[model samples]
Target: MFKTKWFSGGFSGGFSGKLSGKLSGKLSGKLSGKLSGAALAGLLTAAGAAQAASVSFVQPTDGATVSNPVHVVFALDGMKVAPAGTMMDGTGHHHLLVDGKPLAKGEVIPANDKSLHFGKGQTETDLTLPPGDHTLTLQFGDGAHRSYGPELSKTITVHVK
Candidate 1:
């Protein structure tokens, strides 16, 4: 679970599925119209594709206890990492937040304890934090450091013990 000042509601939506060892199972007992397997597969594919891109932390999971000089990494899914020294659509850089407060959209994330910038496509870094529990977040942005969106950002809690 994650807590963020940027969002009001917590993450709640979820889906689960169970599959048994079966070569074939009866899917439809009675149907008026005929349905093709390809059509069903297409619908599922469309739904999956609509999930959209999101950014997350590749290291330092939630509630992690660590020492000083923390190495941080950011992970991107459904999007590509922008090349160093290149800025374009659907790509950019990563930002690190240490006990950070929310900044306005399109604000350039400063290279400080509160806001960190990785505009050169550098996804990992070492940080020094006071020994305590701190909220860490990875926010991806465009060329100008503008946030891609809240959905694209990942937040986690870590304890620097």
Candidate 2:
């Protein structure tokens, strides 16, 4: 079973830092795999994306076509960018979730081919992808690399030509 403390009318308060890894693990796995698109949208709407700090892509607008070595610029609002291990409130680093969806709240982002970590607090990068359509998710993580959840994330799709 999954445990969730959403941000609005349906959830509880005090999702402390201690609830991270465990809460995310339980919730993300179930939500990502089981919920239909409409169901997830409803939950997200109730979760209130506007209430949290958000991460976004400043370049490569959604549905735009571009060449390889795509330049990806990251933008964060309502927070500061700090290198990994800082462990400060309202501060974190940028992670580009290539060809993937936003991770669960407080989930420790995995290191893999698709998930690129900028522990150094970089705001931009040049990425190379094969010719095709790809979904890029801008995700924010705390100093410990635990995600700030879907409310803090932004997803955009682009095509590589």
Name every residue pair that clashes in candidate 2: none
In model 2, which regions exceed 4 Å deviation? 1-51
Worst 10 residues of 1 by lDDT: 7-16
lDDT of 1 by residue, 1-161 (tens): 22212212211112122223231133343321455543433333454523366777767888788876776766776555663355655567777777775455676667654787665567677787777788887887777777776666778998887
| lDDT of candidate 2 over 1-161, digit per residue (tens) | 11111111111111112224654576588777798544554454455532345677789899989987788877776567877898866678888888889889889999887888888777877787888899999888989999999988899999989
List runs of model 1 lying over 4 Å from the truth: 1-50, 83-85, 102-104
Top TM-score prediction, candidate number: 2
> lDDT of each structure?
0.61, 0.73
